[model samples]
Target: MKKFTVLELLSLELKEHNDLDLKCIAGRKGLARKIEVPNVNRPGLALSGFFESFAYNRIQIFGRGEHAYLKKLEKEKKSENIKKIFTFDIPCAIFTHNLMPTKDFLDAAEEAGCAVLQTSLPSANFTARILRVLNDIFAAREVVHGVLIEVFGIGVLLTGESGVGKSETALELIERGHRLVADDAVEIRCVGGNYLMGMGANKMLGHHMEIRGLGIINITHLFGVGSIRDEKRIELVVNLEIWDSNKQYDRLGAQKKTKEILGVRLPCVDIPIKPGRNIPILIETAAMNERLKQLGVHSSREFNEQVMRWLESENVRNIYFHNNSI
Candidate 1:
């Protein structure tokens, strides 16, 4: 239950949604209004005096059709419907395509303490873009310390203790042409209750990484833009740790381990760190294997089944040979 104020929504730093061009036209007093829902309402039926199930909590959008109806009602001296529409505790009113509400409508909004917003984008475009922004704002989020990278189109998160060399392995992956999503602190958000999206906690330091001895280096500047990505959907979680000679590790990939974040279970793999071992290549293979699993091809399970079938055939062959000789 994240509360996003109308003022903060206005000053969103999303670069892709610059076309919204939103500004407060009137009723600045209601800028503190709370926007709870991620969706917006057209209010066409409500403006026509049909108030059944009106979503009062959502931001009301006045598109081209709604704007025309408002102007017609103003001209016909029918201000009762306009007054009725503002009776609810609406968060704000937005007019798209630079369409301005009539004097009567604006006055109704002002009297009811509703913020009126204007956007230069067309009605459909504005509606689509604003919905996307609100969806991200309302998504469930949590921060984790890790390095996220995209290898062979799969998002892999490398996480471990303080001196586990996650950043160093990420640097090697970038050198191999993999894209780096985030370093150090990764902000993860659960999108649509199904997926986890990971990105850098700070946009300013997104492309920068810190190695133990070398300090900080910029991946984008060093490897060009192709080696960096803004964010990625984390599909696998690989935990790296120091090699323990006394402990036995899973060699057949039969042990299925998962780490849950925001209620989504991500496949987990533990890689032991030892001198002379290629961790970056192991991570890349893990990513590719995950992609194959998603396509309904489980190499480990298939191998296990093949081995079982071979043993059964060998037993049958030995029994037949003994019976024929007898």
Candidate 2:
């Protein structure tokens, strides 16, 4: 993880609901201060003259209550605790609901070189949004060589050796009304330690494909905007390899296989590629099958169980007939 500074947070180009709507109010020099943690602390206790377990490293959030309390304190000319709170190495202070801190607080923050930011969003909403943004920034991530596509509403990652027709198959899938998440290098991150989310490594190069003979092509322009997605939760992985005649493949599908990335395991399938084999169709079917598995419909296991039941019934009838005849 690289250094995430307060300036970077301010410069984030989030839109609409996810936007923080933040602007610097004071201490511009401390914009380069590193935000060490993803959490925020409300300095109500510390503002009330108690600093026994004050979390000074976290970004301090001054909501309406904290702001009003500061007003009350300033009315009585009590500036000791306000000055004392800034004595520690705090990352920054954010006043939510467009609330502005008093002059004493701002002066104390400026003197301590602590950045002060203001947002129009209420305290709860801003807290939720910032926490989500921070969690994504600090999540475990990995980059793998593959094409990520969304087939039948399932996120599928295509992985194989170079020249395995991954991009081509993805192109076909896109033509078939499926959406492409990324091409070539897919950046995968483990979100919430339960699911994997994948997207393009670079946003500027989004929805672009580099074919062997086609050079570079834009999927959004060629297929339209509906064919491209910014990101998706990776639900399945398909490994396409050259068809090996000598290699035994899992025809029954009873043996489940998975691939681990960033501490999260995803359902995996190995599709053997050969001349005249429709790789895109195979991948699409794999995606649908994965969806079925998620719905508790294990086709292979159910088929195997049914076969065992039939065999047991045939053996029981045979033994009874033999005993009666004897």
Candidate 3:
């Protein structure tokens, strides 16, 4: 990730609930200051001259309480502490609920080259939205050549070599009512160190797909808004390859295979492409099976267990019959 500055945060084209509604109030010179962490700190303690463990690196948040305290400090002519607060290299100061800072506080921030931002949202709401945005910006990401789609509510990443029919299969699935998350280049990110989130590498070209002879086609325009999604959690990975007559494939699905992306392991399946094979339906079935597994209903394991029980019963019946005949 490149340097994320206060200017970039202000320029983010967030919508609705995710909007920060932020604008520069003072210290415009420090808009290029890099934001190093995904966390924010309220400078209440630091403002009161308690500098023991001041987190000067994070973005400082000024809520109602903090704003009132600054007014009190200014009324008492105690501007020394206000100036001291900006001595450190703080990323920026954000005033929530459209609160304005005292003249002394703004002068101090401007003098020290620390950016001051104001938002119309309440402190709690702004905090939540900014945290969500920062987490995404700071997450570990990688770009892979594949197509991502949602089948039966499961997010599946279709991967393989070039021209192995990944995009074509996704097209078929989209035609069959599945939603396309991204086509061609999928940018996958590890969020919360637990799950993987995948989206289009470029937001401008997100829902566009390039078929062999069809060239570039917009999935949203052709299939409507219902057929496209901006992002999805990658729950399963399906690798499609040319049919190998000599290579063995998993016949029973008793052994589960996995693929690791950014330290997160996801369930993976290998599908060999050949004539007369319905790749789209196979992918749909795989997605459904994955959902069933998540519900603790593993089909392959249950089948193997039932087979073992039947063999044990047959052996016991044979032994009893032989003993009785003797």
Stretches of candidate 1 off by over 4 Å are: none
Q: Which stretches of candidate 2 lie over 4 Å from their true place?
A: none
RMSD of each: 1.9, 1.2, 1.3
Better candidate number, 2 or 3, judged by lDDT: 3
The candidate that wins on lDDT is 3
lDDT (Cα) of model 1: 0.92
Quote the positional error of residue 156 for candidate 1 in Å. Answer: 0.8
Estimated TM-score for each candidate: 0.93, 0.97, 0.97
Candidate 1 has what TM-score?
Answer: 0.93
RMSD of 2: 1.2
> Using TM-score as the measure, which candidate wins?
2
lDDT of 2: 0.92
Query: In candidate 1, what are the lDDT values of residues 210-314, reduced to their tens digit?
Result: 999999998989999999999899999999999999989999998999999999999999999999999999999999999999999999999999999999999
User: TM-score of predicted model 2?
Assistant: 0.97
